[model samples]
Target: MSTVQRALAVGLGAALLQVLMVIAFAWPAADIAPRDLPLAVAGPQAGAVAGTLAAADPNAFEIITVTDAAAARTAITNREVYGAIVTGDGPPRMLVASGASPAVAQQLTRIGQQLSGVPVARAEDVVPADTDDPRGIAFGVMVLPLVMAGIAAGVLLTVVIPTVGGAVLGLVTFGVVGGLLSMTIVQGWLSVLPGPYPVLAAVAGLVSFAVAGSVAGLAAVFGRVGLGVAALTMLLIGNPLSAATSAPELLPQPWGAIGQLLPPGAAASLLRSVAFFDGAAAAAPLTVLAGWAVAALALFGIAALRGARTEVAAPAEDPLPVG
Candidate 1:
């Protein structure tokens, strides 16, 4: 192809990709809806309250009836439920764990107001976000940089050390350094991660490893095209679909469901569980991240072996005898 034609093609492709990203991300925010969101209802009238909520939105909530407000609070803190409605003789009370997701908390409070026969009063946040980050969105912000770092680490590693073993070493070092540094910034300085330091660091390391290893594997398999694909997948598709600023349930339809299974969403879920839920609901997300890491590593290994074999089969380059 001519240079001008090639440039035009590249430009058009980049423009199209950007447009797609915009649509993919904005579509969810345009029409937010709840889907199988966990919730607790307390008191003797809990069953009735749950029924009413069900009638309003049959598929919205997975309601669990608790004995009292205390139990409801416990459930929220443990991440067993996102929010709870505590019914009693006076006005109803709603308990929200803002640390998990401020957007979800706000939405649940609104739901409580609409559902309650009397006025609804919200209790103090069971697990509030960091004081500096009242909206709890800093967590989402932190994720972007870490992901970018992972991408950079993976790409640079391939450029600097093309061997699979070298790339693996680079990924390990990147994971450890990036994880600790990020944890120090978000947890130590910002007080965003209130969980145990060891747990937070461990999860961070896993997230880093998953992202880097996946990118490295893609590059190993498809060369430069693989790098572009990996970038698009992580930045355009994975991150936006993650719904890190809110609960996955608060996002639109299948996208929300799809996001939770990806690395970004899983990492966010795991972090929330660790920080606000005492690591109570972390197992599923942890498994998801582990799967990503293992799969990526396997792909990288296979590609490396194939590359080595190809090199062995190829004829050696002829050398000039004189200068």
Candidate 2:
């Protein structure tokens, strides 16, 4: 085969591999596990009652029974947990942190409705969401772009041994694109999503940065397989489980349960809080994103340095084995 033909074939193969990797990673994260959400419950037999309730709905909460309403309220303010539930003869009241988890917010609503016989009312001590922000919609906005950037970074870095540098380049590209589309084109053609252009731009940049760093870092570790990690992180696992189109409460138990751990899900919750809600909006999400970025950078840095040292040390031994 001609050199040009071989090059073309190799490029196509790499592209195909990347695409498949993305599909594999980005699919099947429809299930959301509740994991460790802090919750406050109050009732006469709060301990046994909360434990039983938690056992019944493990996917819904990490239950903690508070001493009283005042303690519940205090717990929420201090950011000790995401939501609270109080049981009484007449009805039940749930305290939800609107900014923390849209899924949790939705879950409170559904739980309120399901407690038949008893009346349930949601209390508003926590900060409320914006009239404009749709809790779940935030995921699609920031996550989609981030996932794309990650996929691109993974592919570009796979063929090159110093995948870290290539991955950084990919992140830079995403940031640029996000700035242009979300910021510069505020009034352009992106009216499809609604919201101020500035807000969108800021979100876009953050998402881009996170996705790029994550994808690049993963690729540095796994080589071609890193594409799958990136895809799973942003597209499949993160996006579907994210509180994008629907709140966790809105989804079935599994999706709601696992949603918080995903990046898009976390960011989606944060964006909704920043745009419309007020409670603990920035703290958790900022920490999550910063954590992701830091971890990615660390991994990429270590792997990259090791790879460079290896190449320099080994330096290729004789390649003259032709017929």
Candidate 3:
């Protein structure tokens, strides 16, 4: 290719990358709305409440019927639903779990007002967020740093460490230390996460390992190209679609679901579960992180074995005859 052609190609590629980044980051925020967001209606008026919600926005919520307010609260605490409406002899009450997603809580609060046809309505926060970071801004912001740190760890391991075994060791060491440091800052200093320190540390470690290990393993096998691919996947695809800033149900359907399958999304979900929900509904995210971590380690081992076989197969040079 000519020099001018190459230059134009590079410029066009840069422009395309910028456009894709904008779409990845902004699209979800722009189109934020409930899509099959789980909501509960308790008491004898459950059907009526469901009908009202459906009439308002049929595709917004998936109404779950329960016996009473207590059941509704239980469901919210267990992370089964985002919020609930309870009706009895008196006026209806709105139950919200702001810790799950403050944005969703705000939406439900508006719905509550609409249902009552008043500026204010009877409402309760069954699972309120921490006072220190009520809006969940800090929680959302935490994931990006962790991801970047993981990427850096992977890059350093691949470049600085000469052997696969050393890289694996470095990855593990980074995970443990990184987890401890992260938990200390976010939990101890920031007080954004209220979970038990040990568990939170462990979760943080797993997240680091999952991300770093994936990057390192890929790079070990495929070199610099693999490094770029892994980093971009975690940053562009994983970070934005993670829904850490909002609930997964709030984002576009399949993308939100796909995000949870990636490291960033799984980490956010797992952290939230341990931090506020007492580890409720944690099985899926935990599995996702574990799977990534295990697979990454396996890749590293494969690379090491390949290196060993190549070394053994290589023929040695012949000794020079004495002069």
Candidate 4:
């Protein structure tokens, strides 16, 4: 291609990349709404509340009926649902877990007001967020740094280390140290995350390892091209689809579910679970992170074997002539 054409092509590519990044980050926020969002209706009026919610927005919530308000609280604590409505002899009460998802809680609070025909309805936050970061802003802000750390670790290891084993060791060490450092800042200093220090640190470390390992493994197998691919995927797709700023159910359908499968999304969910819900509903995210880490290790193994074979097949050079 001519010089001018190449320049134009590069400019166009950059523009396209910017456009895609915008869409990935903004689309979910623009399209935020409940789709099959889990909710509970407890007490004798459970059926009536469910019917009313169905009439309002048939697809808004996946209703789970329970015997009483206590059961509803249990469900919320267990991360089975975002919120609940309880009805008895008196006025209805709304139960929310703002720590689990402040966005969901706000929406449910609105719904509760509408249901009671009052400007402010009776609402209780079963699992309130920490006082230091009531809006969950700190938690949301944590995702990007973790991702960047992973990308940096991966890129540096691939460029600096000559062997895959060395890269793996370095990545592991980074994960552990990074986790401790991150927890110290976010939990100890800022007091954002309220989970047990040990567990939170462990989850953070695993998240770091998952991202860094994947990137390094990809680079090991496919060289620089693989590094680019991993970085872009984690930054553009994984970060946005992570729904760290909001609940997954609040985002567009399927994409929200799809996000949970990626490292960023899984890490966000896992962190939230451990921090607020006492590790409730943490199995899926844990599994996803583990799967990525395992797959990355497998990739590293494959690259090592390939490198070994290449070395074995290489022809030996002739000995230098003696004087």
lDDT, candidate 2, 171-247, per-residue tens: 66666676566545423543323445566566656656676677767767776587666766576567766656545
Worst 10 residues of 4 by lDDT: 114-123
Clashing pairs in 1: none
- Cα miss at 258, model 1 (Å)? 1.6
TM-score of each: 0.91, 0.58, 0.96, 0.97
Using TM-score as the measure, the top candidate is: 4
Model 2 scores worst on lDDT over the 10 consecutive residues at 185-194
lDDT of 3 by residue, 50-139 (tens): 998899899999999999989999999999999999988776788999889888898999888877677777569998888898888999
Alpha-carbon local distance difference test for all models? 0.84, 0.62, 0.92, 0.92
Per-model RMSD to reference: 3.1, 7.9, 1.6, 1.5
Candidate 2: where is the Cα deviation over 4 Å? 1-37, 43-60, 77-79, 87-90, 113-125, 138-142, 153-170, 176-206, 217-225, 242-266, 269-288, 298-323
Could you give candidate 4's per-residue lDDT for residues 1-323 as a string of tens digits? 99999999999999999999999999998999999999999988889999999999999999999999889999999999999999997767899999988888899999998887887675899999888988888889899999989999999999999898999899889989999999999999999889899899999999999999999999999999999999999999899999888899999989999999999999999998999999999999999999999998999999999999999999999999999
